[model samples]
Target chain A: MKVKEIMTKDLTAAEPTMTVRELIELFYQSGLSSVPVVNEEGRIVGIISERDIIEGALPGYFEVLYGITDMNHLSQKLREIEHDRIEFYMTPEVIKIEEDEDDLTAADLMIRKNVKSLPVVNKDGILVGMLRRIDLLKDLL
Target chain B: MIITVTPNPAIDKIYWIEQLCLDAGELPVMRATRSYLTAGGKGINVSIFLARMGIENIAMGFIAGETGRAVERRVRDEGITTSFIWVEGETRTNVTLLERGHEQRPIQITEQGPTVPPDALKRLLIHYKRALNRARYVFLGGSLPPGVPTQFYQELTHIAHQHHVPVIVNAAGEALAHALLEKPWLVKPDTRQHTEIAGASLKTPREILAAGKEWTARGIEAVLVSHHITHDLLITCEGAWDLEARDVQFQNLLGAEDALIAGVLSATVQGASLLEAARFGMAAATASAESEELVVTDRTAIERVLPKIHIEQLL
Candidate 1:
């Protein structure tokens, strides 16, 4: 079966210019930790997740990067870039799959990329839907 | 940012039933073979169209109850930014029944929508003014719900102009008439409800051109009038042009006008000339009319239908 057969439909994407605060609200509204970011032409430019938001928002993140504990500064860090756009923090190198690709290939790519959700594109490379890891576990298993 | 204001938004439940029974006697309930639920509001339709074309825009309006929430969620899924003001009562739900053979005349039962309380209208003004700060274009579409004054569009147009933003007024009857006095950038009166626009006849090509020219002469930038779903006449500051879509098998005409508005505005924002924009818009409308969906957004399919859309400038 093709990935499109089980992939979620009517997936929403965020624009790169959206503020971190806005993206967070979107994550809350969509109940998704991450969403594909698209350019003006609707092509997938990157994918942003709670991981990126956490990394980008938290102050003293540099120290925390080296495994230093800094939970106290989390609130301060989140407010610092609340208004900053997500372009810099987003993962520009996106690993996407074609909608028509086999379900086995989709699951294999997820394992290789170590990602939970993969953006699905059409033959024209336009973002269409998203295939979640949970969907794979439910269907492929 | 482009802001689309849908004064009254609705959830459209379209059902393709097995058959239509017209007798006065009691009949068995028809079964639906297919169905679709869409976010239905003129401005919302345009917002969806713009979003699908990769243009970021804001969909603003008043919403109420769970039906309203459903409409907002559906449009948000299309990637259109929504700034809805919550009101009391349930938002309207329009039921459209389409028979297999009579696709043209779908039975429609639409409610008047939720009443906008005084506080909600005030909040809308505040939000509208704030949105105007970043707005490049504003589209005021659909009719006012109960409790909202007819001069609502006029007031919004006046404020948008104060912010130096071009406003597109797409309404009918008193709403369109009041907005006209504000000299909106363009006026595309909603013709779905009535054959006549502000007591003006659009029955013939000559009357359509005359009517379009009348609005343009009122210091408005342009006026677009549709005729018989096959042709459209556009009168702009520079000149007038006639666009005719040939050989289109119209499956549904519900959202064609809104698609035209979106197509034109999308092109206008991209720096396309008025003539070119009208041509593109008519093609989009034609593509929409030929499909069962409310609005068709496939770029390739729309472009393929472009050549069949003939346009000629009027002397």
Candidate 2:
């Protein structure tokens, strides 16, 4: 089985220019926690996830390393980044799988990258679908 | 009466979950503590916003299946007039999973809307004819469902112009690009849509101004560029104005643009000048962002922000 055989085709892609607030609205309306960020040429530029946003809103790594815990300050920080564009927080280094790639390849890629979802692109590198880890498992079952 | 059209409408389902955990080789199961189902679509949002502002408006669109019925029923319950053409397939359902607390970002899943048959499209146009006849402003919004041509909004705008009704279009991609040719009364394109139409990244107000000029040259009366709720740039044949306000922590950013549209329309209908209308639009957007409800009509909240708005007019 190939990635396209099990991947979800009907996707709601994100634009690089989408603000964090707009991304949250999309998440609330679509029930998706992560989205493939696509550029104008229909190429997948990055992947933005709920974790990425939460991390972006939270304190820096040094603060966490220093064991600074202030809930109110943390919440205030979240509000500050809410209006920032997704690209500012999105993981530009995305592990993508081709639509025609084998299910085994997708499973292997996910395991290697430790990513839950891999954007499935075509020969032109335009995203056509998204293959979740469960999708490959289901195909195996 | 203001008439808003949404060729594709859906039921927006919002789920508030405690946490989201996905395990490989296992089905992810999460419980939602709170949920909301609202009638959704770009035009529906505009109509809802207008109605909340005490403006008489009609929401016209193609709705189908049980979800469509539910959407129509819900909109009518909101005290807004509904004129929807019943189509064949079920209306799409969009899902949003929001983790508890404002800390977690939301996840959105959008389903493709039902395909509108040619007959249903014809019926919708006929309804538009009657609705446009009485409409002071016709708002053509959202993407067309499958089987509808990209030039759909262009044709609809032409019809509205023929009926002497001004049109405000909020669309993206080809729909927006095509409608610009018809010179709609106003076009509100968010950052992404503006970039798509301009085919370039617009980072500064100068780039935005140049793009606005390009669109105005095409005869569009006004180009409203909504920059992620941070700023709203309004360019007209007369002059250009960039309005900004202190960012308030938003409950939900949904319908902020619609709120802006409603504010501008409401102010304009009351015979306010273009600059005054833009101010009201900014205030209304801030009020909407201050609430979780899709559209806000808290006049007090809107008025509070009205004075804080800083408007810079570029001559």
The Cα local distance difference test for each model comes to 0.84, 0.78
DockQ, structure candidate 1: 0.04
Tell me, per candidate, how large a share of the native contacts it keeps: 0.00, 0.00
**Candidate 2 error regions (>4 Å):** A1-141, B23-25, B100-105, B192-194, B198-203
- Indicate which candidate wins on DockQ: 1
lDDT of 2 by residue, A11-115 (tens): 346778778877776565445699888775557899998778878887364545566467787678778998898999999988998889898888888998888
Error of 2 at B301 (Å): 2.2
RMSD of candidate 2 to the truth, in angstroms, is: 22.9
- Give the alpha carbon lDDT tens digit for every residue of B20-52 in model 2: 777734788888887888898888887777777
Please identify model 1 stretches exceeding 4 Å from their true place. A1-141
Candidate 1 lDDT over residue span A87-134, tens digit each? 989999999999899999999999998988899987867676788887
What does the i-RMS of model 1 come to? 9.0
Check candidate 1 and list the clashing pairs: A59-A77
User: What TM-score do all the candidates reach, one by one?
Assistant: 0.70, 0.65
